[model samples]
Target: MPQIMQMGEHAVIGLDGLEALLAGLKRRDYRLIGPTLRDQAIVYDDIGGTADLPQGFGDEQDGGRYRLVRRGDARLFGYAVGPQSWKHYLHPPMLSLWRAERHGQSFDIIESEEILPRFAFLGVRACELNAIALQDRVFLGDEYVDLHYRRRRDGAFIVAVNCSHAGGTCFCVSMKTGPKVAAGFDLALTEVLVGDAHSFVVEIGSAEGAELLAELPARKASAEDLAAAAAIVAGTAANMGRDMETEGLQDLLARNLDHKLWDDVAQRCLTCANCTMVCPTCFCTSVEDASDLAAETAERKRRWDSCFTMDFSHLPGGSVRNSAKSRYRQWMTHKLSTWFDQFGTSGCVGCGRCITWCPVGIDITEEVRAIRDDAPK
Candidate 1:
């Protein structure tokens, strides 16, 4: 028998009750998006119920390598993040800004009629929540907010998951972002499995979450359940496979503008821009205008861009960061140092997507360590 102990707003639900939660969200007109196995990797996609989740599967991730493996149990969220981040849904790779049709003597502008969809993101990791918060500062905090991003973000519901396992490339412990969720979620869940029983300890973070929990088959969580959840998160934190020393990291990069370490990494870097694509906080984009052959119709589009591209630095004189060394340095410095000046926080969330997805296994933490080690003593 499960003991019902009321401690604040925490509750426990059987693993089977997860379907009820999903159903409630869908009934409320939310497009549920969660992790699913696709192309041999766990990627986010539309999920209708527990069947759509990556059951009995986990992921093994290291620098430049990611593979899915069987965990022998039906653990819905037993893996780490893959190449796709929530940014793909919120800030799409491509968007049509506007279109225009030629008139007799002028062109009439046609306004974009795109409607942002309401999404409920499930199985979001703690570090990913911080990444979303950081992106909120970028797209919603500026003087002129991104209308599209704001619309989508405003109606989105976040269901965060406290990590029970850490990837080999994960370094959220050093970034002070994860292993446990502190905030920025509607409902947070910690998967608990012992012996042959499986359940989840759910914590309500908002009124909407409380209402949703009421609709699910959950009971008040006991003290033992809460303690078990804490221990699981603690174990994950202690076993982080990577670490990043952030002491004076901002100044360290700023002073090493001419560091030779940049050249060393550039030789191995393919300038593929995979890091930026997989990064949850990278917000660079480029705009293009396309016209029909008859020049009667034209449309303006914006697509995700990266600083690693030579064309990204094209100016009146020429490309400023022409060499790969300069381009890599610019990207790293801006991500670690200049981002603080611009956003008041580190652009990176220590999710390690950049390291895992990079074709050359270029680790950001390793680069930072190399720079710090080679600095003038």
Candidate 2:
């Protein structure tokens, strides 16, 4: 179901094309969800039409954070990424697996069933793509695939974006995952505002993308178009503030487990679980069992859990990490240091969601820098 278009180099599509693309997905019964300015933040929600998108909306971010603001123009999709990543839909924070009902002699297990709606997520950021990949490694490729997650991810489609602007807390360039769109996306778009043409230079990354491209009216690209996109990304890369040297970090944290730097961070951290809640890679969860008044019927639900919780590491002997310092160390070490040994990849995508959403403004980048810089001394 694909049609190929030979793009010379300057192939660009107008804003109308974006609408057409959404309509096409709707025809195919794909639920198109995208970003909308809500609660002083950009949150993804059901988009019945283009107007639902955050038009002329942007965000101001800081050490731990985001606040939405009006933009210069009313470009619906003009905004950059948001703290609410695609994981909210793909890997739901809380979900019900099944329910059990007691009968005269036996009990019935009612499994939760969702038709696995087809989705087309627009405006996905590069770091978000990495986050999805990391989640895939856990839910799909782990010892057990989360049936709910697999259902949502397998049938969903992606439309990634190259960031034209970076927020205050953004460090994707430092993480080497952004400023430009890369792999793991069906289609990538670079919004170009050149001379008088304000359009997007789109690149098809999959067979499905080719089919979508055929439906849109686009012209051949010129060298100038490519150059403009490169310039945008290059400029963005240079503007990034935070720098994280993750080289040999996994080994360093694993070796130096008793470092005193963690205590400093612990004193500042409240263990309020904000970091894990916003983090896309933190997948640890716990389950709850609820019973009706008669206690004959019960419903079980799984919810996101945090290692910062007092009982997160509770064992038969005792709590492995009793002190806040030990809990903080366990979290940071797992995030930047020991995750490699467990998951074979960096547990962080550097989306800065953790930093921006933290109520106390505890910066993960600064913490890592302090530990990394002092490790040598």
Candidate 3:
């Protein structure tokens, strides 16, 4: 049964109620995954029970970000989304696609599809929901469907969160993906522990989600609870501190290809590629082949590779983007500007993972602002 219950007149879900829902799904052969404190940070992992979840936890972050110590108040799922996203599951860093085996003149081509694990992502944030949708448009759209990506994404259950706290670098409001989630989640949860009754305002977006909400220990919500939940969303949206102007900005950057901004940023940019690695939307990859000296058998492995790498854009003679400055321009332009042309959407969701993870604290928004504020020629 679904954990969604009534808070008098409005729907509500308590922590215990949510655990019950996860447990219910697990019993139905679903592999449950949720956030837990690990590696000194909150990371997504398989969940055994509610005990595995980071309850009453929140994090503070800054540029070249560091997570704040756990909060004084214990509110499980209080924190904003962390650097790790659902991308790891859908677009893994490395994967083996096929192995060519041969004996004498006879050979076999063995290709295997990644058997997707049935799991419930317990606390996907609003912005992450947008990120996931963006990837779907890229990987599952009309042109080409990534078989592995489709299999993993098609059936996975989503239990999304309405972020209670905004990270210092977060610009979801500017990106127009968050503060309040509107669509694309199976089950949306807004933590409404405004008083003694710690619970979530639950809304069902799919029948599967509605059915899950029915199994929990819950009561019908009152109008007051609904009002409180709305207030919470309102308050969170108002609190978003970072904003960006994406209107016509893509063409602005593309037109200004030779703009001095690229040279200035290249000075600080290490071409380390941490931004691409951490970015939830960047999906470039490279393949490697392993074989025996006799060429009897071999395997092909696909690994996440970056354009920042000197070899990524290589041709017969040399790499097209042979310089760090040119590579940086390519990455930023593709990400911020031309991505619309290639994907029909912006590649960045403004999660700020790139800003936070870059070793030298190079902020993309800062660069955009410098470009925007530069004198018009």
Candidate 4:
């Protein structure tokens, strides 16, 4: 029941046309990775077509609470983020650096080489895009770039989705990273469902996207279709679930190093490193060497680590951050304040993953509000 009105650069496609898009990407030798329902949660994984998407499914998210619910409509991109992010795909949790094998007296070092896949990411949100950009600075900005991360990032294609429904913990609007995608996408889509008519307004952001669209059955978008898409984005922007006061936040944390707010947060924090693990911007890691009993072979491996661990701050004498209060203080200060000195931007993207996935439901926004309220007047 799709109508083809005209022909142009921008177009509108019915929900059924999604398969054509997926097929087009596959024909180009790109592996399509998208959102799907797995283990009672929406996760990013390899998908085949529209049938693999989490259709008619939505999620309810709040501080330390998350539940999957029926949306009553077959909306493809209706849910917010789950526990997983694109980070799991780009930067692996455990990476083998190299292996050594004994050949007579000397040992031969064998480097770890992996075959990087060409991936096309579907349903990428605006805040997630910002997170990926921030990670780019961490892995590829300097001379000592991570070759593995660079290969995956450079070959991946992004298809961003403009949010129409905001989650209970969502605050991307306050961080100016969401509701409407500004950049970092090959193609952007806004889902528009009105009166039993489900369609999408697609905007091409790259030559590759344009070529792909040309291969699909689509029509030039009309004025009414454009208006409907704009209104959906506007309404989503107006209904933000939480807000963070970023004005002078950097200086506030830097000056309040000895503030009592740290103690209050430490009492509730488990120091379990859930925040750092779920965080899309945290890049801390640890390396280790493993060898056999005969010492005939050895392997070097790198894995994700967190500041909450005692050994994370190990020095010549002892660990620097001994108490939970000191560890919590260091984490918050680095994320909101000192991160600017190191990366020129805040470490948080307002994605609310940390707030939703925390075991005790410790809200970062609430913590910041408490500190701001108790500051010297």
Candidate 5:
């Protein structure tokens, strides 16, 4: 057995070593989840090995647009954030809360017996890491705790990947969240491709991460390797595809509740909830209870719901946010402005998934700028 690694250790590993790392995680009984080619796009799914990674594939992302493009070099993690995030694994879209069965006017309640999965998240980006941390605040907070989220989160291992290239819609630099991973990962990897040599500079963050690294055939990272990795991250930061002026953004949105720009955006908004669906931190959900035709079995289930839906804000009389303008306002303002007051952090991570996945190409940063520009002086 390989010795467990300690914190603050740096090492270098080749492509073959990465495969060994995967096999090692499997041996520890972790279900591997990472990005792979699916339906012409890179999506997070079950992986057998590193071969399942989307190698030599980059992505093009802009407002309401996403496409996969082939890269000249065979870099395993050469793309930016895709449509699907690690949230799909952590916070499932649909979940069963509980179930009950009836017998002659008597009811027997049964808790959900859903088996939890221990996930080893591979290829997590910096912005995505921040998003995960934000959700942790929501689910694993001091006052109230989500046992389901806590159990799954506590058991998962993280493998964060530093961005080598910026996406067309990325603004993680302006958000101060990406290009270079800060923390919250078991192991962080920076892919280095120089001349004919290709390897990963690994930074061990936790004891488990260190133990996993010890399983691989890794060498101590040289000064040149560290410099190369830093250069790649710096280059990505310098070439960010988008920018958001976050200074006083919370107050800005608070003052512009009735901004005309909201009305303008509503014209193009579909209220399809794609932004909320793709957003890694949008945690809104609705619950329902239903019984079988024979009224013998009943279940309580929870499904993801967005504020944009007409029924989401329905009251005793009618829907409070009846207009598209109000729904868009609620989402954008809550995400960029009021979320700080509620969560002690900004809701948006600047991943640009909400922008790329929005059918009408509604850019959150652009809307913020417009609101600020049009605000009373």
Candidate 6:
């Protein structure tokens, strides 16, 4: 339910008010999860408050390279996407499914009773919002619903942050996914820093967001404040670090199944699955059942898997896609081309984790261009 008058309204809040927003969510029993500096990289973890945010920190990311740098400004949420995404929380890498105890004649099955977190994701980016939505179609679809994901997702509150600056590998603008957050958030923020004025221009997206704003000390956004926020997003869009020609991209790849570029890229690929591991929309998993020596008790667990692994395509007799070329093609085509056939949208939101985190610097955008460049006339 929306407080019709408050929904879509914009307000400005200073740093102190931003801290209060976190405290308010905490008072509502929501565990704070956001980015923080750890081990020389900005990583998402439990945040106590605004202090845990990566203030005055920015990142330099290119294919196969990432480094943290000081921004010299006390601006929180100033960095680009890190190696991890919100999927790490919503759809965990590993989860226990069930357990069984054998008692001679029959086995008793015990369902997993792990407690789910009521999360308030503090600094979600626009591209990430798209990633989360795509995942919802996978886990909460009409055909089959993952109860574990549903429970966690239902209780989560999203605080989206429009990108103040783009990353070296970013192409969310080309993907039509970002620079500015369009939808799918409880509250959206645009960090505005002009001269001595450092504040967040907040956009209320729901009744809950409106109620939360009521608790915070904020003022109505002025036309100049809103324009400044718009300018920042527009600047980010103009200087996008990368771009891909997506027109008929699905058809382009569908026509190049035998392209030599696949072989060339595969030769450089380690089949390490680093790209899939960091991809926010990737949902593949492998289930394992473990037992003790006597086999009296057993547990079933599900963990993230990747198409890059030979075992991922294994069938009854042997692996289906045995060659590295085949595996690499499967991943890229599925993400950029075949995903639309299955999910009605692209799997990639162009956050570029796959590009930046790849050990061998294989850029997905470059690969797409290579295919387009060599397509049969």
- Give the TM-scores of the predictions, in the order they appear: 0.97, 0.94, 0.94, 0.96, 0.98, 0.97
When sorted by lDDT, best at the front, the candidate numbers are 6, 5, 1, 4, 3, 2
Tens-digit lDDT track of model 3 for 91-148: 8888898999997999999997566768688888878888898888889986768887
- What lDDT score is found at residue 43 in candidate 2? 87
Q: Any runs in candidate 5 off by more than 4 Å, and if so which? A: 1-5
Between candidates 1 and 3, the one scoring higher on lDDT is 1
What's model 3's lDDT at 239? 76
Off by over 4 Å in 1: 1-8
**CA lDDT of each prediction against the hidden true structure:** 0.90, 0.79, 0.80, 0.88, 0.91, 0.92
Where does model 6 exceed 4 Å of error? 1-5
Candidate 2: C-alpha lDDT: 0.79
- TM-score of candidate 5 on Cα atoms, chains taken together: 0.98
Give the alpha carbon lDDT tens digit for every residue of 183-287 in model 1.
888899999988788999998888788878887888888899999999999999998979999999999999989888988998999999999999999999999
What's the lDDT for residue 210 in model 1?
Answer: 80
RMSD (Cα, Å) for all candidates, in order, is: 2.1, 2.3, 2.5, 2.6, 1.3, 1.8
Tens digit of per-residue lDDT, candidate 4, span 308-375: 99999999999999999999899988999999999899988898988998889989898888889999
Q: Which numbered prediction scores highest in lDDT against the true structure?
A: 6
By summed lDDT, the worst window of 10 consecutive residues in model 5 runs over 1-10
Give the deviation of candidate 5 from the true structure as CA RMSD. Answer: 1.3
Q: What ranges in model 3 sit over 4 Å off?
A: 1-10, 375-377
Model 5 score (lDDT): 0.91
